[model samples]
Target: MQYLESFYNYLQYERRNSSHTIVAYKNDLRQFCEFLEQENIELWVNVTSKVIRSWMVQLVNEGVSPRTVTRKISTLKVLFKFLMLEDVVDSNVAKHVITPKIPKKLPAFVKETEMDFLLDSIEFGQDFTGLRDKLIIEIFYHTGMRLSELVGLMDCQIDAGNDVFKIYGKRSKERIVPIIKELKVSLVRYLNERDKLFPEKRNPYLLITEKGLPVYHKLVYRVVNSYLGQVSTVVKKSPHVIRHTFATALLNRGADLNAIKELLGHSNLAATEIYTHNTFEKLNSIYKQAHPRAEKMEDYI
Candidate 1:
């Protein structure tokens, strides 16, 4: 527990990690420590491969997903390695712990036709809120930016002349994502209404509520869920699904994986590769439909 307190301080000051990431790390480490306590284990140096394996088995028996168990194992590995470097542990006991192989599940994405219908259902009336929501959906689908990145955007981040917006992504890394021409037009229309709503107050954020305050995650989720419900019957309708929709659309249209990686602000190629499954599914469907031999013909004899 003392080590955890030190590690948290290290994360906050030394590593400069984000609050969300630090909180996840804290939770992971806390759970591991709790497991150790439950097993009557003490002293970091006494941690062994056997103990870690037992903990993993216990997690599995408790109905935790393989992916989650793997992540927790990864967190322990990092902590043990850190302890080893600090001389608090004799060695990294977690080194020999094999992580569970989680099955890759591609995120569900909305089809292009469904996306079109969703956008069309926005009903671009004279109402400022409707126009604003439409622009919000368009920007999200077109850019594939994380919800935080969109909400944290400032007026200075937009390059109106070039039609590109700079976003600070995970780890405070900045990337420029281009706005499509149509999205730009919609943004301009929304801004016009926005000015009418808050003519006296000037805020840098692109999207705001009727109260002229910055939009929050819940508001964004509601906006996305409401529109997606009208267009698709998918059970989960959130901003993340819109992000999946954007990634799949790009992959289906033959966009480069590396390009998408940069656009989506993925630090690793593996994170971006999930969209390939969607692409493969599309190709497989086409192959089955168009190829004469894809479906075996009954024996002529």
Candidate 2:
């Protein structure tokens, strides 16, 4: 328990991990501790690779998905690595365990024409909620910001003069994203409406409900889903789909991968590389349609 407390503090204060991450780590360690107790293992040093393997097998036998078990195994590795560093354990037993491989999944995004229809053709309402919802969709589609970043965004973060807005991304890393010039119209309108509604009391957040309260996560999701459903038939009609649309759009338009990475506040290029598949797909489509020799083999054969 003392070690777990130390690990939690290390993740919170020293590492500055997000709330969701800290909770997941705690749950993983707690589950592992329960397994230890069941096996009559009282000391940290007494746990072995075989014991951990048995636990993994038990979890798999209980019908847990391999991906989930892999996540639990990752949690164990991190915990044991910390314990070894603290001199609480002699060896990191989790290092010997193999993680299950997961199938690669492509990021889901809305088509360019579909997004244009939603933004240009659709007429959102004129009231506070209407203007706010439109701005929400524009920000996600144009900026590629995560849901949490959008939720935590404040009024001061926007730079109307330069067309750039600031985002505090995963792990609180800050990056500047530029909004399209046309989006400024919606931006100005939303701000004007926000100010009009809350004349005496000011909320620090840029996007708020009619009651002047900061927008929460679920409300943002609801707003996105409601509007996206009108124009997009993509299986995923959430804020993340808008993010993927932003990235894929940039890639299709010849934007540099690293620049997109920086704009999206991704920590590494590998994270941004996923959008290349969408780009390649678009290119292959054009090649088959335009090239003279491309489909000649089909006719000749």
Candidate 3:
């Protein structure tokens, strides 16, 4: 436990990991520590690669997601590395284990035509929940914020007058996302609706439930899914899909890669480059249709 606490402080103070990542690391380590106790392994240094393999097997047998299992394995690897650095472990056995393969799937995004129809054609009611749901979708599409960052948003973080809001991304890295005029109007309306619902009550979170509690993950997912299900055929209709739509739209419109990266609060350009695939696909389609020699390329080849 002392070692675990030390590792946690290292992550917090030294590594400056976000609260979300810290929680995930703690949860994964807790499960591994429980397994250690069951196996009667007293010290992390005494744990072997064989025991780690056995745990991975158990996780697979219990039907844990391959992605999730891979993440847990990574957590163990990091922990063992930290232990070795602290001189508590002579060797890092977890590094010997291989990670599971994850499928390569492009991020799903709503088409521009589909979003245009959804926003312009659909008439969200003029009331509280209606305005809230509409604003939820609008914020996601407009700002490209992750679900957690948006959920954790506060009224003070929004600066409608300046047309920008402060976003706290992964690792709690702060960025300012400039909002458009339409979104600014939607936000003002949503706030008025919220105040009407909870006139005497006070909540710090910008978005809230009908009962005035801060909106959570499941509710946000349901809101995005239900709306997207009506308007889009994309298999993924979560807030992330909306985020992808925002990024892809920017890329397709000739937004600079670095600017998009900054706006999305990505830690690196690599993460932002995924959106380029969609733009490349669009260019390919255009070239096939309009390029004079595109259709007859095989003749010269």
Candidate 4:
């Protein structure tokens, strides 16, 4: 517990980790420390790979999912590496601990038709709340920004003259995402309504509540959920699914993978590569529909 605070400070001040990520890392490390306390281990220097394995085994036995266990292992690896760098430990004991293999699950996305219906068919009124709600959905589908980044959007971050959003992504890394003409028009309408209704500066956030306060995560989630529920039957109608929709749409239309990586503000191409699977599925469907030999393969045989 002594070095835990310092480790957290390093993650915050030095690593610039988001608060949500820091809290998750904190919880994971606290659980690991509790495991150590149960085993009568007191010092980080005294910990061993074998002990870490035992902890992992205990987690599996307790019915933790493989993906969750893998994340916990990652947390331990980071913590031990940090400890080694700070000279709190001689070497990284968690380095040799093998993580459980996690199954790759494809990200969920709304269909293009479903998105079309939601954006075009749904009648969001000309009122301020209606304009704000419509703009919220449009921003997610157009920008592919994370929920946190969208919620924390400031008024000045929208570079209208440049036709791009200055998005600050994970770890405070900034990336500029260009906006389409349609999205830009929607954004202009929303800002005008927002300013007209409020008429007083309460917060710098671009999106705000009906009360003119900055929008919170739950509010944004509800807005996306409500609008998406009208058109999409996907189990998750949250902002993230819309983000997936954005990336998948671009990929299906032959946009460069590297271009999508930049637009989504992903730190690595691997993160953006997942959407290719979705695109492949779409292509496979098209192939089946168009190919002459696809329907009756027995003829070829």
Alpha-carbon lDDT, every model: 0.86, 0.89, 0.91, 0.91
**Least accurate 10 contiguous residues by lDDT in model 1:** 292-301
Model 2: how far is 166 from its true place, Å? Answer: 1.7
Which of candidates 2 and 3 is the stronger one according to TM-score?
2
**What tens-digit string does per-residue lDDT give for candidate 2 at 72-111?**
9988888888898899998899999976666668899999
Q: Kindly report which residue stretches of model 2 are placed more than 4 angstroms away from their true locations once superposed.
A: 1-101, 296-301
Q: How many backbone clashes does candidate 2 have?
A: 0
Our model 4 lands, by Cα RMSD against the true structure, at 7.3
lDDT of predicted model 2: 0.89
- Give the worst 10-residue stretch by lDDT in candidate 4: 292-301
Angstrom error of the Cα, residue 255, model 3: value is 0.3
Candidate 3 residues 142-204, lDDT tens each? Answer: 999999999999988988678899999999999999989999889989988788778975879
Pairs clashing within candidate 4: none
Candidate 4 TM-score to native:
0.68
Quick one: RMSD of model 3? 8.5
lDDT of 3 at 35: 89
lDDT of 2 at 269: 97
